[model samples]
Target chain A: MTTSPTERNGWSGDGALTDMAASVPKAARKTSRLAGPASTAEQWPEFEAVAQPQLQGAAVRRLAGRRSNNGVGSSNSSSSANIGNNPSKRRWPRVVLIVAAALVVVALLLVAFAACSISRGESSFEGLMANAVIETGANAVSYDEGKTVYYNGHTYVLNEDMVSVLVIGIDRKESAAEDKPVQADAVIVVALDKKTGQATAISIPRDSMVEIGRYADGGYAGVETAQLCLSYGYGDGYETSCEYTTTAVSRTLYNMPINYYFTMDQAGIGPMNDAIGGVTLTPLQTIPKTQIVEGQETTLLGTDAYNYLRWRDKTVLTSSLDRQDRQIQYVKAFAKKTLGAAKSDPGLALSLYNQVSSYSITNMGMDEFSYLASVVMGGNITGLDVISLPGEMVQGEKYAEFYLDKTAVYETILDVYYTQVD
Target chain B: MTSEQPPTTSNPDPKVPVVRKYRRTIAALTVLLVVLLLSASGGIGWLIWEHNQREKAAQELAETPIPTVEQPVASTPDTPEVALPDNPIDFASIQQTSPDVYAWIYIPGTPINYPVVQHPNDDFFYIDHNPERNYAFEGSIFTEMANSLDFSDPITVIYGHNMHDETMFSTLHYFEDADFFAENDEMIIYTPGHILTYRIISAYQYDNRHILNSYDFSNPEVLADYQEYVRNPDSLLVNTRDVPLTSTDKIVQLSTCMTVQNWNRYLVNGVLIDDHLTN
Candidate 1:
């Protein structure tokens, strides 16, 4: 089983020594004998001198290791030559190299996977709005109005373009029901031109004189002509009050027909604000009445902005007209913030739409409203003109009266409503 | 070789000593080689498995999708069949479900589709809960929950509720940082066809009631005075470029409640830039 030393080191009896010796230069052939076993001091110099050249040459050759040769060798040239002929030993290094390469490939793939997972978790505006809509229960309103309003012996079909909308701000403090009739704190008249997509808004002062629409119910029938419009009616029936009020106001002030109405109460504001995140508003002066109200507390995500708006008494407002102007300020502020927020986050916009739809009573259907939304969203309209009704106190024998300045109101409306666009 | 030796017990296997030494050396070398080979193979295998895991994780990460940023539209289409009339207001088309609970505001630049909830109890809109039955789009605008349009005082304060989705005035922070405001200065507001363009004169974030007297908008003189105060250089987010504001100017004030402090208000001041009709 065991071969002689010569056979073990080399494949043949001649081994690789004879061949290596022959390959050496003739002058260096003497160095071969010097490599022989001779442990003696006197022979050391001779052996070193002769063997130095051959040893140096062998070292250089070994340093230039080629991957194909596997570079497995010893100082003994015979043994190296014999081992180099064996193909099985050479294949060992190739297996190791292949395994290393496979490991590298696997590592790269895992890295790629981890990177993808991290990127997917980021959230955006549109998604947030979608979630918000689900959270705030707002639905689309249908646009089917069974009847049309007759104006000047001509029936006016209820459409988005040629509609007059009355935007009412109601003060609903006592009743918890969403449909309860609340007193109107603010009133705005909006007329839309369907063909042009142009709108005219006229702010109606709360103190203006007008005959309340006679209702079968005792609540609004006897209300004073000067009281706010919402102090008299509720729900679908409120349309009559809007019709009568629109007629009287139009005749008494702008001499125009009123068509549509939109009413909002206290319950719906929070979600709308939450939907857009929040709106930014700049005040003309500093308001100091910052008391926390009942049922309203500050949270990490929610803050009480209503108290700031309600801080009227402490703000040194000189007149009711001043308060009306402040209301306009709030509206403009809301407009800028909401529009800007919607641009970045569609989900928030959708959420706000959903929330508002729930508590609102509007004549516009979902489809018609979407068209209007597209126009507003697509075009820029930050410079819209806003005008308020003119009013003055009238001295009477029995009661002090506030009368609407008909000429001023009409002039303001005409200017806003009759603009030519190029 | 045939020398006569002392008669001692002689064993036939006399070469056993040399054979035993050689065998021991060979066995030790074999053991070392085998152990080295086993360890190397195991090391390579572990490295390969680890690398594969990492690659898989990276691949999964690459496959994830990022959310889109824009306004949302109604799933249904808006066509002429559902259109409202051209003249006289259509009361029936615009339903008032909760009178005073919510109202619809149409701004030309806004993506609001449905009626927005009117938060009478609070001055601003709630970003979390949707006002039931209202147009609860993600970024629908909300007005001051309780502020009035009183122009009699020095400043008329209006407040809007901000949302995390950046729907309302979440972008208002862009103004708080100086560089952002420089690029954006104009916005358009639409009420039906009444278009109003506003110019951002200055923007500032303040603690709630920092300038207490400026919220009154009733007095024209007071309003002018409040504008001056807001234009002061010391304000947190204001530009003191001497932007002129007058009583004749119909200014728009936008306010939002912030979580910075319990009562802190973040206000964005803008002036009426211009007004024009689209159609």
Candidate 2:
């Protein structure tokens, strides 16, 4: 069994044969360990088979008493085995790293998609809600009903186009005995021209004398003439007040048939003001007094504007005409602010429309409201034309009674409403 | 024993070879870290720049001023002034003139001297025609020769539109109640020959019909009815103690359209009390 000197020299001539023989045994043993626990002891036998040649050569060298080269070679061989085994053990971490990286990317993409959808939805919802509210609220009133009335022996149709719509603001008290709502402290008429998109605004003093619908006692016959038409409307129904007041006013001077009507209580005005941001109008004078009436003061910026329109009983103002002037100022200021805001801020308009929808009632439908707003936005009517019926034109009782200036009123109406536009 | 010993003559080698590998692994990790950091920094810088641009545009729009209507452009004068009487009553000289003849109205206490041109068409006089001239400024006043204060009879009703600019009869709106009217009760109207001071007596809104028919210049009963109606004791601005109107008291009515339709016309009626001829 001992190797000859010639055979030994042959083994030394090529080291690949020795290295392969060493690796084959270790590879077979590792594979057997991975396969199962059953042939564990047999693995050593297989390993020994592969290592026998190299071991035999080493033993031959050892017999010759050489140690350092064998030690280093064995160390190198073992290290190579360790490096090879490391990649298999590291496999799990590599798979974990790849999966984690893929998950992070997917999560980021999901967040981005969610954010974009939310932003788009918010803007779209805002616009849709605004349009809905405006349309719904504006449909409450009828803007197109035509009523015919006689004035100065001539009959005229009071259509939305030719008639004046008086918006009355009434200050109501919680405790005050609820007679019909209090007299209109403030009155403004928007005389619209359907054909031309032109409108005239008239502010009436509450103290103006005019024939009102007959109330219980304060009257001559069935006629009660006074400036406070709201008192009549409140005491009587809208139709009766319209007839008595319109008839009296028509007979007095150049009055025209009445058209649309809007009544806003004090509570309604506040929200409308807030919805439109605020009305901006020039004040006629620096009002020293804060409160126009007891418990009613123009402290806030919005309320202050309201006060100018509502102030009716103070001696500081020489006459009702002065109050009328203040009312006109408020109208112009409100118109400018409302129209301007609608043009610039769509979100703000939506918010305002929503707010106004809750409190305001208008006869105009969605189409008419949109049309009216568009006309104003188009800049057709920039300046407001204000006029009043002449005193000499009206006739009635001294205190609360009054009449109309028929000629002047008709002429004014014709000029404002009927004149053909080129 | 001799045979077994002969079969086990060769011995096996046990030393193992080890190789250390560091260059490739270190290089891969370093490259991945650098790529992640670079991507994060670039994304953050882009977002900050977009936010600043939107803020700058909003501030500039808030500072612009609104333009006014009725500003007078260069144009020839419309209404020719009639020659004054030989006595030549000099109310203050015309402060400014409008290109159109529409009318010239003067009030002593306020700054309302402007050309009164018809609004839209030449049918009704409105102050909107001349922008340089505002009839509602303080110290400007308006007077119409045709209107009187007492609503009793066929009266010439002078009208002035109330304006937000405080130019025309804007101040008049303050007089509807008692206190505001008391503070500014007396306003003098200056015609070419006579300076007339009017005492504000009554202020109220009348039915539109009443305003239309009350201007019958020929009927005395109509004027009487107008006067009686305004003299009500319960008036918010006027009390019974105010003297009854006499023939000497000519009326001046200042009027403006109310925002309200058909309900009423905002009316300010004043009686002419003192007259002075200024030459």
lDDT of 1 at A255: 29
Q: How well does candidate 1 match the true structure in TM-score terms?
A: 0.32
Instruction: Give the poorly placed runs of model 1, Cα more than 4 Å off.
Output: A1-162, A174-181, A193-200, A216-224, A230-255, A285-288, A291-303, A308-319, A344-350, A393-401, A419-422, B1-279
* DockQ for every prediction shown: 0.01, 0.02
* Model 2 chain B: worst 10 consecutive residues (lDDT sum): B1-10
lDDT of 2 by residue, B19-136 (tens): 2222233234335434543553444444344334323322322232221123223444673543322212221332244322233334433443433332323222222223224331
Cα error, residue B80 of model 2, in Å, equals 77
Quantify all predictions' global Cα lDDT against the true fold: 0.41, 0.41
Chain A TM-scores in order = 0.49, 0.48
Q: Where in model 2 is the C-alpha error above 4 Å? A: A1-163, A174-181, A215-221, A230-255, A288-300, A316-319, A345-367, A390-407, A420-422, B1-279
- Residue-level error in angstroms, candidate 2, position A376: 3.3
